[model samples]
Target: MSNVLRIALVDPSDGSREALKGKLLGMDTIWLEADCSRYEFFPDVIEQTAPDVGVITLDSNPEKAIELIQRLATSAPDTAILAASEQTDGQLILRTMRAGAREFLTLPLSSDDLDEALRRVSQMKFGSADAGGRSCEVYAIAGATGGVGSTSTAVNLGCVLASEPQNSVALLDLDLALGDADVFLDSIPDYTLADVVQNISRLDIQLLKRSLTKHSSGLYLLPRPVELQDTLSITDDSIRKVIGLLKASFTHLIIDLSKTYSSVDMAAIESATRVVLVTQLDLPCLRNVVRLMMGFEEIDDLHNKVEIVVNRAGLETGQISLKKAKETLGREIFALLPNDYRTMVEVRNNGVPLIVQAPKAAITQGIRELAEKLEKGSSPAAEAGEEPAKASESKWKKFWPGVKQ
Candidate 1:
């Protein structure tokens, strides 16, 4: 296998098909050669091109594209699937991810996104060889339902984890539209995850870092789109590309999962090291979590990795007790957070992570506890502190628990 990243662009739309292919060709460093012939039928196209990366810009027959992705995952396990966006829908995004799409690209492409996507593909090819596949963790943070503090929890947890001096973390705000991760952190990012999707063919570490907005706290944030009209859709190839890019740069990655079950959310969850389901003391949230946990259990390899996080845990609400909640779900409560209105209001007004503004508060304390739990639950980092200089063992040795190679 040569270093050149072979790419196949499959799309029925003439404009998107030509535009995407042309953009990849124009990039000088990315050795991307496209076989656009896959636009006819993705399955047939994959058979003929057998590219390392496959790009699907299908707007008319999305189901067909999904079918092709599912078929290709088994037929060609090495080929990465990328999907171009015409619009953004939570269900569509999740469905695509579960169907085997790696990433999604929103319309009105950006040069940075294209550049980064290509770099991601190249890295994925090499990283797989370095290990058995790739060295990364996928952390999924999903709301039990809407307005249960999932976005806030995801953002703060990621920010706190990223704040550790020696550890690098990437916080991905996966809620395509109406995602408030930027607002929560009070950051004015130049780019969002949507940019990464549109330019899935040219992603690299340098480009990925450039796309990020680094906080003084040392956290790398990939924000969501500020504009309500902007679309974000990615394919398996693009998701893999972006995830691979993040993995190379950061030791820990925390993903803010979209509340709605769509192709995008599923893709993010599959790539996550752990899935954190954030719930509140309410029937709606608990019921939703119950349903979602059941749904996750149906998927292979996901049931064991899913963790239920009870946010705003202690309240005078008519809900199941903590023990009963765990009994009902048949899983342990990963963590419990107290409901603190004063701190939440203050942090919301300041537009900063609660951990930064209220370190000693109940919620913040719980978050810190959760962070430490995650750090310990993993390998080498647990034996040593979070600092790399303090590591007594090799990084590879630390990774022995999950390292297959």
Candidate 2:
């Protein structure tokens, strides 16, 4: 019994129960103490066997199954509960977690996923100190407006972070409609975010690693769905679940969000350890930055996490100065990415990141500096009581002559 994980199983479907039992029996570390076909009798079995873990399948009667989990959580606090269901709905996963499930498995479970879940249970029961206390740093990168090079910054930063031997990085493209993080890496991933969400219930480290496309630079990427309609199925809750799983598996998670401030993007932003708001020195971009900052101010502590980055700085002689841009935003500029149109174009066309294409280029060096700043855990030092520039209709109308104000 030393180093063995004892499991009690309950599945209303006899076929599913048999299949799960067969899988469990195959694992050398698992000990199948007792098996039951009904939820009502599972408690009695648990009482008799006193199994270290309880496995419950919820497809037959989810409500009853969840009730059993809740009961076991309180009554058998020593026993870890593992829930299984065919449903991949994010709400169901959230409910299952809240009901005190130590792990959740999707139907027709991947053997690897099941093994990983059991390993987690083993650690929980036996106290594996080596596998404890790992945390992932998530950085959500958003463009102030279209064509502001937000995705470029995210890809390059992820690449640089992945280059460090200490970091295991994953770059998630949240720009569902038009994400090209995979394109930037020159990777045609067999799996995408749609696939991950479809199998969100069984998403363990093994499944997740297999689903992502690993790049030559060592950064793992979960690209957007290939089809436009697939994006419709992706919900905010699903995005949160994905982020949670990614945070658990990787040392660093980089999310490149769409310019549209949708609920999904906001969910990612809220989950992120830091929000890198990439912008430029132009009037339109600056205006959007002001609007976005104002919106961030409304959310609790979101404004503090925002770090404004200026891309393509000094492209034009008439471009806004860094000092003026900071004064306009009422916050310090987090970084100034040098304007290198030729190098960026080459990298984009070649389907490679800046660090790999031209490591010595000024723009590549700028990206490295940005990554260094982030690695050092430096955040924007927003002035006390400072307010972002108000998007006054009068101020903008003067520039465009719309004359609405």
Candidate 3:
């Protein structure tokens, strides 16, 4: 790969655009390959030119500018984005940086400053640092009831996702009963969720990373309170702060939530980009899934994000059929797993996840496929206000025999 930095710029204003263009054109080492008036043209520009560094102006269009910056960061992780703006206020600079801009420049467009910023951008492209632009997607996992394998699913999913050498995953145990995630991961940590909440106002990416326990597979675990009493000190505000901080540090955040819908649990769920509601096929678990789905229906933002998963679905002892279970819930089953008691028990006793211990097991195969779909950005869950599929209803009725939708 050539060491020369290829660049692109986006500025809506003609005067500022020309000024930036003039400065960038004269640079010796840096080549400016693309420039445009609107931020909308960035992805095409990025694709066509494959710029190592991108400069997008942030001014009156802070909303649009920030959105584009995030899109570019996600769409082209290798590109280092710099947000140039006339407003250099501390708050604006922080917002721009948080939105995934690698460098923020307050503008009258100084050549020396531009050179320095480009130097840092070039370093990012080739450096040992995380090239993901600090972007993350939070997937919240909540079981309908205990022993439904919420922790197993969350921790194993985290491990599977982390198996990708480029992926950085964080697993947060929010059960607040001093969750069993540490036990599941066989992790003995120096810090827990309570410690983060105690110093939440001071928690940043580095500090938060320090508090988490890193597994051998590269998954980071933030254990819940060690003492049951300490769980009382965890508040919703603290959970929100910690989750936000983690989102900035990791590429994928997997949260294991307890059955109780406490404020802290709700905070994580509301913050999640996808909610994985894990349930068994029994009456209680099925009922709980329906109840939770109905409750989620009341919230606009959350209703559409629910991904219903039926764990232990194909066991000979399972009470409900997969088709019938989805019929009872009246939604598509996002994913299903066979009952693998022997493997699950052995792994739990060994304190390791299936992906690491039994990668070829049928259960591991199912979870791995689930991980692939999530990593591929596809969810088979139904949306709010979406009528149950006509085909689904017909098949469901046949599956149920006596039950009516």
Candidate 4:
């Protein structure tokens, strides 16, 4: 099986088809390789896309759906079939399952329900398809204050990590209403977090990937809502669900969060394997970093998980020295990006990450070094405490909850 599980959608209902397509795109793991209006076309679409699973919508013609499921079972025995309909009848479900469908979902699928159904079907058929999947790392980037380069750090970090062919990265714009993380990479995603929130009921791994805008750097982007009002609809539960799903598929999951604190932001922090606290060398930014560190310290070892990243370092002489910042924040400086407004603006205007547009730039090199440290499982020498030597065991174990090889 490909690292990404390929899927095909067959639904005549325009609303359902479009909704399903949006949801599938939101997922980083499930690839929507085919979409046809009729099950009659499943054979042809399947032949072309060679999907591992067929999400066949069975609302209009249950009998035909059943027939197609049976036929596909016989002809394309390798392809798994999942049936969905608005029908709640136990009989309808039984009929579809009896016809060789691996799973069934009622129509207008909720994200939670779809995710559960797919998980069951995957476990049954692939039996730990993620056994060979990359060891996942999740990083959450937050700025001490707005315009502190957190989004840039998160975007470029994800880009460089994914620059390696073997790595898959998901960069999520969690700034919600005012998020412009996509602007940093110049990605205009068709579906954003707003779409995911609106269709949360029907979201699954495949649907989530469909929502993301894939960048030239091979990093997938889950941008925030376009309409500011839409942000109000997103709940902390949805944030948790989104991050949880991203962790399952991508090798690296980077989140760019809003500067201000919120319930959803806290949820992301709780789930993050590491939090990069991006700050500039100004006094106010340093003060906020100290305050943030205090907040992090309240939680046992959360302070350790947080690594200070000073952006635009050495841009201005006689600024708060790294030594003073560390003394104030009581944590080591994890990374220092050089000030390069020209290179940064150029790349942002071009809609590309620094690593892609100007690989040799100082800021780009800084981001790359951070990525390398992450890959090598090393912490900066100044990082607070001796326990970082054991960080991977404590951090990585949370992502993969339970699955035997």
Q: What value of lDDT does candidate 4 attain over all alpha carbons?
A: 0.78
Residues 1-405 of candidate 3 have per-residue lDDT tens digits of: 123466789999999999988887555345566788887877898887777789999885999999998898798988889999998689878878888998888788898888778766756666733332234778999999998998899999999988888778999999888489888889899999899889976554556788889999889999988888998888888887688667656778999998899999999999898899998888888877776765676665586677888899777874787777766877788888888999999999999989888989999998988887776665554324454333323433433334565
lDDT of 3: 0.81
TM-score of each: 0.60, 0.67, 0.66, 0.65
The digit string of per-residue lDDT tens for model 1 on 1-405 reads 123455777777677777776676544233343455454466676676567788776585887777877888788888888776777888888888888877777665678776566566666776643222223455788888888888878778877887776567788887877787777778899988778878767664556689999876677789876666555365555665676557655677888877777876787787777788889766677667766755664566665566778888787767668876765654567788788878887887788787679888989988888778766554332243443321233222222335333
Please provide, for model 4 over 67-161, each residue's C-alpha lDDT reduced to its tens digit, 9 standing for 90 to 100.
99998888887788988888889888888888999888777888888776666656655678453333357788999999888888888898898
Best by lDDT: 2
Q: Report RMSD for candidate 2.
A: 11.5
Q: Where does candidate 4 stray beyond 4 Å?
A: 1-133, 378-405
Candidate 1 Cα outliers beyond 4 Å, as residue runs: 1-134, 235-237, 378-405
Better model by TM-score: candidate 1 vs candidate 4: 4
Ranking by lDDT: 2, 3, 4, 1
Query: Per-candidate RMSD vs. true structure?
Result: 16.9, 11.5, 12.4, 10.7
What are the lDDT figures for the candidates, one per model?
A: 0.70, 0.85, 0.81, 0.78
TM-score of 4: 0.65
